[model samples]
Target: MSTVAVPELAVVSSPWSLGPLHLSNRVVMGSMHTGLEVQDDGGAGMAAFYRERAAGGAACIITGGIAVSDEARGGPDFAVFGVGGADERFRAAVDAVHDEGSTILAQLFHAGRYALAAGMVDRHGAPQRVVAPSALPWAAARGVVPTELTAAEVERTIEDFAAAARSARDTGFDGVEIMASEGYLINQFQSPLTNLRDDEWGGSPERRRRFTVAVVEAVRAAVPDLAVTIRLSGADLMPGSSTDDEVDALVHDLLPLGLDGISVGIGWHESRTPTVQAAVPHGAWLAYASRIARVVRASDHPEVRVIASNRMTDLRDGEAVLADGLLDAVALARPFLADPAIVDRSLAGSFDLVNTCIGCNQACLDRSIIGAPVSCLVNPRAAREVAFPARPTTDPKRVDVVGGGPAGLAAAVDAARRGHHVTLWEASDRLGGQFDLAALVPGKEDYAATVRAARAELADRGATVHLGHPATVADLAGSDAVVVATGVVPRAVDVPGADLPHVLSYEQALRDGVPAGTVAIIGGGGIGVDTAAFLTESPDEARRATEFGARWDVDVAETVVGDVPQRLPAAHRTLRPGPDVTVLRRSGKFGQGVGITSRWVALGRLRDAGVRMVGGVQEYLRIEPGVLWIRDEHGDEVGVPADSVVVCAGQEPALPTGDEADGRPTDGLVTGLQAAGVPVAVVGGARDARSVDAVRATSEALEAVRRLAP
Candidate 1:
């Protein structure tokens, strides 16, 4: 790649001006459940997380859900903001973020009936009934019944919110956003389904909205200058639940509570939507945001600005929402993971290459549930800021990168930060190869974000980019050393239909849309199963009519429309693209190829989608025209008819021939120059030291680099 001048940036523009606080930019970091703080000093860990983002360039930071009271905590390990009272530690946390130059806020929450009190047994191991508006069993853990909050208990709980808010102000936090969304305590009180009470706090929409109002009024009165925000789930994505009209009514009712703004959020933790928020486009949750804006504007609450979130990842999308007046500002979570300097990049006008959130719920939501420290799937530096900050090394080292995928990108960025002049080469124009296809899968967009962030880091680090250029012994011409990150190649299978014309690989299928025909995918691994799902029809039923077009034959739709439910089912199903695709298990069943944890989740989606799964590859035959041979569950050989055949078996590395290796690419004049001696190092999937083949190849490369090293 040729050198290009990066435009200068103006640091003056900002996105929010709430009360006495003037935020530098519209990019707000949403609350993330950091498991690090859940265990030890909540104050220290919480402060570090916020300080990292603040230092990295977030205009405003919202700390993860801090419980208002122990009884209202969603889990035992969660941070308790209400416990410390108006203490010195709390003040220090607020001061920490302020010192980093960004305004910070604490999200005061009460999980209510959602709290797993049983898990929080005392030292002697006894169960407890956490208080709630009504005596209700936890939806997730049905046997656990929560105690109904008496009139006094309810009053005390409201006081907890007030106290937490007062403490947040005293601690020097710029603001506080009340957590009322995602079916938490405030949400439970807001919804009639959870609050089946006869008192003034239940039965009607006005009554249901009372608890939230009381907390807001208390918080606002306690901290006059602090930007008081409220986060609400406009649509819970639950069936037979409160309608949008009811939610709007609740918002209007709370508009008079003197809130600085209402931050709109969508979806529950267990929501089926790949992108949690509803009414949002692929990358932008404009619909849900627009609704929130409409509700607030319709109320004519001049003091309350609507801050929109839910799938708003890139600055371009944030700018669009701001331009359309749908929202005053946009809040994000995963984008910061991909690139901590999101705001700086946006200001520089390189928003097109901005690393964004691909909606992978792994490090954030998954780890939080498992009680593990929440980190980014792509950006490994998320929770390691204080301990392993990404800073340049004292002295520079000449480095060479072998692959151009996630791991390679990570290594390259880390090396560049160490002040290395790096050269990263890919034989193709595309930098993200397999990752590009991975992102095409539903909810796997974060893979692309990882790739984008890698490229940005490389550029910022001054790493030399060489595309469509293969490295040879001659290319190793000059350099202190090299690190081979050569990624893995596809694992080819020797099957009867392997050489068939229609038998396309997973990469090929993503590059080209799955045709409307009888599609049969071979292999039951993560890649194979996911490939099958993609080849089938989409699980989104609302778009089925227009999305199918002329391809909507009754048989085709039925075959493609597997068992994945449109709503969150009693049993969750793995979400995959379904457009008349079938799976033929060669050895193991579905999800065998993916990672264990991810496989279990994917298996659920597949089962829910009602996919026709066949085990064992022994019943196989040949790809004779439109027919495929497979054995049924009864161990009988069956002939399945298909219009197209696809192979998603996986990948391998592409190495040069012996002639090219010997510096004698005399086959073509051009091939000779392509063999320019270059020090190449490979990494990623195939680089696992345990694998004999990978070990040998790696050893050979290390030896070669050693010979060339000066």
Candidate 2:
């Protein structure tokens, strides 16, 4: 594989100014919630997380949204800025970011109606009531209407914003940004669908803009010296939401009210649009920033810089957009999460080593939504910086790693970095066991980059890699310690006629192509859903277009639909139909264990591809030549006729089995080896059968190597 050469960045590394604040560069760390505040140090873990990014050369760091009022809190773990007893607690966070020579901005927010449904409690330990412009619930709130804020409550809310900004200024923060996007309280007041009041807060465009404008004015008045920015939704992207013109008009009205800068945030939580997912085209939201930049340049407040955000993965992309004068600076949230030194490395021209974010959102947004601490899928030390330390070994030893999958590769590289001689052996010709299959799934090509990076790191660290060489007990005879990461194998089902040629495991189907005909997949887990999508070739625009044309009887030759047939004359004729696929599972829900952030996109793609999904199966009776018999939820046996049946019933730990081995779980390998006077450890899927994702496997590998080094 050829390397993707990094282009020379032009304006991305240059210094920029946002009103009174002077940034060292154009790269800004956008605000993202990190559940690290659950620690006991009064947000010290969260502070350390931000400090790392600042020390790595991010020009400015905007802290995650901090609630101003007790009723505005999202949860107990969320940080609070101006609440009565939390002044010193937030000052420590600001001091940490400032110690790294980076300007820190506190993002003050109020969750509003979303807070009540989020189970947020007040200072007195009672469930907070949701408040908005009108008595409407967000789509995710399950029809629970919010209490309308009275006229006096609206006045008090504005005062709360003022107090938050004043508290930030007193706490030594350089600035404060009003969290006015992403379906939060301020955005609810600006959006037409959420703000349906007949009072001064809602009614027409001017009345709707009253709440935001008043908050800005009050915050600016409260902290005249501090930089006051507002994060606005460039496009709500929801039905009956604010339009581009309305956003433009709102920006026009807010600029005169002492706004220092504007950060463009795309989409809301309830938006049906694909905003930050991997499937979204790179720089797809740049045009929205450009539209706002055009509006900002036209207004009298030209000093208010426009920051472009969403799906910006590389500095070259930011440089290109910055050179085009569409945006003054670029904000990156996930990229910083993936690599804290992203800016410094790009500036030093070490692009190959920089770990770019794959936009998976698995560990970041998805985990945060479930009230878990945010961590990066590729970088295990993101949130747990203190817990996962990388220290050189005082006494180096020879290490043998028996696997070339993610866990083994990680172990080899970490051991080599820690002054140990390491050798990694793989039974297969290539690396990345199930990860390779995962990369082949639709909209997941970015996963291949991870494998490439691991391979490159191993080569650079001088770790010996032996492919197609299955390790035996003899290989570990001379080694001081051994790490086994043999990974997992698909569990076999005990249904009748399971040995039929028509039945294939998920790995088998991925290795050998799926048969062309009706297919029934057992187990609606992540693997099964991904396999169904793989067989259907979902989200492939050309395939979807062809299928659409075939279903609706539209002639592609005459009509120019979706700009495909007109551009490529042979697209219509070269289109091939995918196989008819159905997914069967014993559980009620499909795609279990899939992240909430990307689950809808995955399931929506399956639905669009005409895939049938039936869950709540009581039993699998049997699998015949071209038929699968299963008992449905109604206790009635049904025969599902298909050309092939694929089983993705989940994985089991692959333990050693031979005369020399006792066939025990891999965790016992360490104790057995220690009994024999050899220091050995187990990592990755071999360590456990559940929750063996890339993040856990890599972290376990690093920890295991650290333990064995000394």
Candidate 3:
């Protein structure tokens, strides 16, 4: 196993004080919706989830946004406190955090227009009516215009916040945080674009600040003993939203209301800005928090500590941000999801073992948004902490895992940890199969971390990994059980001229580089879209410099445009005019298999790279030497001229075959192995071609190994 150098210790591990509350470290587990609540017994899963993070070394844990009122409820599964008469349910959770030597804060919120769209229903079983400061709808909310909140309703809402805070204190929570960010109810009133009332709650900047100030005062007075923190959107990023001056004035007004600290959350859900996705650089939103911190530090209310959030996974980066005095502490949500023991691992100087978040929100935010129980893409046992605890096998045996892809590696690690004698075989020299190609995608280099972690884990757990060796039925004869995880084999599309020299597979193109000039790519799934991104110019350093130079009327010359190398391969060489790439999908849309959280950003990047996308192809006529013929959705024959045609027509399961099989290869490994008088299980793409992603592959492998016990 390769060792990674630990970053120098800094303020991340140092003790800090948030008013009267004393913390063990600067690491705070920011609020993330886990959807773990039982909706009856409060939440056994929720309590266990917090306990895991607390045990790992978070100084503070903020509960997922809990509804303060019936109208404010985010969804049926969301945690509720004051209005639901279920405050007692959270007592166990708070006590569990305290027992773990960490302070827990309840985040109270009202979703407002976001609420109705979230499918939150009232106790009467009727759909909750959407309400906002004005009769405006969030752009994403479709045509669901919210009812304007009356003055009496506004007063009641403020009272509900105070009641929630009081209930949080009563329930043994050490602190309470008001969720005024993320275009929630409070933020709806804060943003000028959403709040268009001429009344006291809107119009002037001061009036727009009224609701937040009143809530702070009410909550502070109601729960004087408990710490009070307010989460504010440093920038809404929406058109006509609150300016920096307005935010500064609002902070200035709220600072005098006995606030404990401020957590700066950036961007709104309605805004077309990239906030926490993979494409967004780490600490991209730190400047927003810095601005607020600067205002607070320079003000008479210097005691108000600022907490920065969004895309802060690495503790080293957090340390840098703290050392620069950008913010008092860093709040991480997704990192905790990826690895609950992030703080402990960083403190122990085992940086390599830390499962860093790849910023793929597939299992976390995407699932939560659809009212599903949230889990981590890499770490499957995130929310199921109690349910999925690793246990040793009662009856251990020798296990042979064929293939060293994500599925095979996962199985080897799990089997070895369970006291089984495990050996993993790979036909290739490396472990990661298609996952290596996935890492090569633009803005997706973080995926390599997962591959590295898996490799390190295989080594640490004593799993014998044999590279460049394919396991046969004879090799697994002595093993108690065999797991066939050979993954997938790319299938060729049944089209004329597919065998042309200019036409290449997506995998081949990635490995040997795309040919220069115009290229037509077939298929528009995740692979095709990612391949398009790989072929196009990355909108990073060079693009930025070019844009900057163009704007300033400066010749970029040597810096932006360099002399072309003459020794490069024809396939590896990029032409002077650059590549004109067009992606064709047989389906209606591109990036169909992409996670909802990052798909928009990925497509946006592809768009910015001048990649032409055409979907709903009626038929593919054929691929010629320098031109590809296809019928559009309207049955119009389009001759797309190209230097090369790259086929990303997807993959098929590479199940074991030959004399080891009962009949055909598609009969599957389980049937084949069983016929040969051997017990066998199949996982990942080998089990089902559609199950090609990391999330499914890892999960299926883990479950398969667990079932193999005894």
TM-score of each: 0.79, 0.87, 0.90
- The Cα error of candidate 2 at residue 506, in Å, is 1.9
Distance from true position, residue 547, model 2, in Å? 12
RMSD of 3: 4.8
Predicted candidate 1 versus true structure: per-residue lDDT over 570-636, tens digit per residue:
1222333343457777675577545433555565555555666667667566776777777676777
Candidate 3 regions off by >4 Å? 1-7, 39-42, 82-89, 117-120, 391-397, 417-420, 539-579, 658-669, 676-678
lDDT of 3 by residue, 28-89 (tens): 89999877653554556677888888888888989898888777866676656744536655
Q: Relative to the true structure, how large is the alpha-carbon lDDT of every model?
A: 0.64, 0.77, 0.78
Better of 1 and 3 by lDDT: 3
- Give lDDT: candidate 3, residue 462: 80
Candidate 2 Cα deviation (angstroms), residue 397: 4.7
Clashing pairs in 3: none
RMSD of each: 8.4, 5.6, 4.8
Cα lDDT over the full model 2: 0.77
Per-residue lDDT for 73-155 in model 2, tens only?
Answer: 66566766645436665677778788888898989989888773456667677877777788887666667678899999999
Q: Give residue 599's error in model 2 in angstroms.
A: 1.9
lDDT, model 1, position 384: 53
Compared with the true structure, model 3 gives a TM-score of 0.90
Winning model by lDDT: 3
